[model samples]
Target: MTAEHYFSAEPATPDQRGEIAFNVAGRDYRMTVASGVFSAGRLDPGTAVLLRKGDLPDAGTAGTFLDLGCGYGPIACVLASEAPRAVVHAVDVNSRARELTALNAEALGLAGRVRVAAPGEVPDDVSFDQIWSNPPTHVGKAELRALMERWLPRLAPGGVAWLVINRHLGGDSLHAWLVERGWQVERIASQKGFRVLRVAGKTD
Candidate 1:
């Protein structure tokens, strides 16, 4: 049997499903999870820190948001709940993960606002006002860079992307690389060996 990887386009592992509960910004959430997805066991620590420290959109916020690499729609659910006026695009490579996200979004009554899709399925005309992710750094540097390269450019003018990466996994270096590439990167928070980066599109 092929040992399933979170990045697998099709996770061959038998679905071992689970549920994880968390509270963000005083809102409670219980979401479905399954094997062969990133951080399927719990709310990942880096994602926790990113949600805790990163700026979230408000109820009045009206714009498009992207939850890049959404595994089971936790961030997408939160964004849809908090910003009812906004639309959320949840993108992932794993089909199983996308399925779980769709289920979770419907369960949370957020299916109307949360659009779950494979990375390639999102419409090319859709641009994000804010992007949120705890990227899959285990995918290796070159692939990781390529993932970011493809999505980050879809940020609208003045858009911001919030990312949390393990410090041991080249967090600082990635921040530096963004700077070198003309992204205005800010180290918003550092905790539990993870760095939260706030990257703004460079305005000419």
Candidate 2:
């Protein structure tokens, strides 16, 4: 198998199924996973940090949320459960990831609330009330920046995004870059060498 890269549009690793369990917001979840998807073996550390550090939506939260680069739908499932009135779009480029996400959502009884779609399949006109991602940082600076540029602008007015990145992997530089672009970026928390950023819509 080619050296695995989660950002690869088509991962070459032979699919091998497994399961992972994580607790968040007082709930425990056991989700299915397989090779070729991001963190197929377990919930990734950056994602774990993001979920732990960022503000999860309240029970009364409404409107649509975007789980960008969702792997096996952990974030999406959590969001759906926390905000039952809201719709969640779980977007990923990897087909295996999408399939696994769908399966996990169904297993969690959240299939109706979580919509799994390929990145390009998200409706063009839908804006998100919140966006969450432990983005694919290994995609390189240019691609990573482009990915943010493409998605951040789609946030609804007054919306925000939560992201986590390894501190050694340009997290500080990315904070500066977003600030320069007029976004209000806050380093809400740093743990396990990961930086959790909360990004608000541009005011200027």
Candidate 3:
């Protein structure tokens, strides 16, 4: 079997596609999944926990949001659906993941609100009111820290970031690391061995 990383710029695996159905916030989602993307088989467990435990926006919420490392658009779609007035940027390193997110957003009539893009494609001037992520911890500590360092500073003033990490995957250490870097980190929930962290900029 070929070892494939979901963060690969281009997955060498054949695009064997399928569908996954999940429910979040009383709404059901059916999205396209394929080989080479993260959690192509189902809604990822950490992601599922994040959605269930994190404070999701409502229909009246209005602002720019970021779905960092969006796999097949589950978090992106949910954000767009829950916050009708918000614009969601779904970003991923994998081209295949971006394609699937676009496809799913279009299928759900959220194409106008959900902007799918590669990490670098997001404009540097854009800032997020809220950032949601189930980061690629498999990428190693340095790479993961780099990813957070690259994006966390882009949070708008008073903005918050929601993240879910597997406990065994350095979740506690990550919380400590973020605090050490001056961000206020809170472990909001722990379920199924996953830690749901709510992070925000420190106030003066």
Candidate 4:
């Protein structure tokens, strides 16, 4: 049997389901999680730091947003809740993760606004006003770079992306790489060994 990673397209592990609760931006969230997904036991530290340190949309915020690599929809749900007028596209490679994200969005009454899908399922015509991610660094540098290359270009003009990366896991190098790619990247916050980066298209 092949080993299962959280990035597995279809995890072979048993779906031992549970719930995780956390608060972000003064709002409490309880989400359903299962085995074979990323951070099935709790909110991931990088994700928590991203939500805490990154700038979140307010109620008045309106636009299409992407929560790339959404694991059970914590970031997607929060974005939908915070910006009721906005739509959040929660994309993940893991089928179980997509299922859990859909379930949690429905539970939180955010099913209408949170669009959970596999990476390929998002429409080609859609572009995002904002993108948020605590990307999977364990995927190796090449795969990680490919992920960015695949998605970062989907940002609408004037759009911004928020990302949190562990310092020990090439966070600084990623920032440098983005700059080299002609994107404007700034380290907006650093806490608990994670760096929150604000990235935007370069203006010349």
Candidate 5:
């Protein structure tokens, strides 16, 4: 299918390796990427903004953290690095993406801290203290909403989620949807047509 379909469970193309570099919280990260993952060639701008603006957990932070649509484990890696005591669960449907994320975690010597898995593989009893995502908005609005519906509730009470969505790609609409669903949604930051949303403390 199209290169835009990174969420496909099985990517049609062969894995072609690439690398990208970016900084988060004053630390630079260089990671291997490949076809079948999100943003194979470079750091995603929205993710960069999310990492730059979203609140990062400190070393004392514990409990599980979910990195939804983890790509090559950038978010997972950063979460593990920042909160060493926390368990980071990285979930993606793409097999190649999961493979690369696991590889990247091992390469970065974070394998013990990061757990890469398919969405269904995550234990039902598990909940997260924090969740982070640069969601696959191109997957269509219905799919995007379903994705959020599935995972957002996995956040523990008082837990927070950081999401980055392109403004033109229904960012505002998604914010409204989350609010309507009773999540306290805040537009924490914006850059390069992307909206960084901070979700926490549900309220009707």
Candidate 6:
């Protein structure tokens, strides 16, 4: 019984469904949207920027990927579609979001590769070669930092994370924070007030 925000473990609101149509990397996508999910109205601008700016893995790339805070599985589907050899884990706190992600993955015929789950359902032994997120910055600083801490540490050695944050929403500060914590963070791109960060594990 958690609260009913988009970050809630179980949202109490009925799912009044909608759909968002967009194209990514020359491919068209029309994903399922529902009430109580993040960015149900459209593909979030930050996510759009991240997907456009980040260097997505190619078909030959093979590894485990994590789409932390995946909403309706846009990132997950894209990742799976781009790199058929890779496996994706789409984790979200919102149960409805998880449901929509699973449905969307199935719709895309990616159910065999995209594993949707609640945050706690991820296996402890699993780590990721790539982590992609447009995290919930509105979830407050403490919760946001905690979210990063829990997952960022699980990045496989030399792996990278692609993240997008609204520039006005502590984006610069979050970049600094990650630097202080020893990650090599770079502002890969910025558009529409969103900063795309390429976060890599420390090598030196």
Using lDDT, give the best candidate's number: 3
Which has the higher TM-score value, candidate number 1 or candidate number 6?
A: 1
Which ranges in model 3 have alpha carbons more than 4 Å from their true place?
1-3
At residue 171, candidate 5 shows an lDDT of: 100
Superior by TM-score: candidate 4 or candidate 5: 4
Better of 2 and 3 by lDDT: 3
List residue ranges in candidate 5 displaced over 4 A.
Answer: none
Against the true structure, candidate 1 has what lDDT?
Answer: 0.91
lDDT: the better of candidates 3 and 5: 3
State the TM-score for model 1. Answer: 0.96
RMSD of each: 1.6, 1.3, 1.2, 1.7, 1.3, 2.1
Over the stretch 16-113, how does candidate 2's per-residue lDDT look in tens digits? 89899999989999999888888877788999889888999978999999999998888999999899999999999988888988999999899998
Q: TM-scores, in order shown?
A: 0.96, 0.96, 0.98, 0.97, 0.96, 0.96
- Tens-place lDDT per residue, model 3, 1-204, is 132568898998899999999999999999999999999888999999999999999999999999999988999999999999999999998999999999999999999999999998999999999999999998889999999999999999999999999999989999999999999999999999999999999654
Provide the lowest-lDDT 10-residue window in model 3: 1-10
Candidate 5 lDDT over residue span 167-204, tens digit each? 99999999999999999999999899999999996884
Error of model 4, residue 177, in angstroms: 0.3
Error of 5 at 119 (Å): 0.5
The lowest-lDDT stretch of 10 consecutive residues in candidate 5 is: 1-10
lDDT of 1 at 133: 93
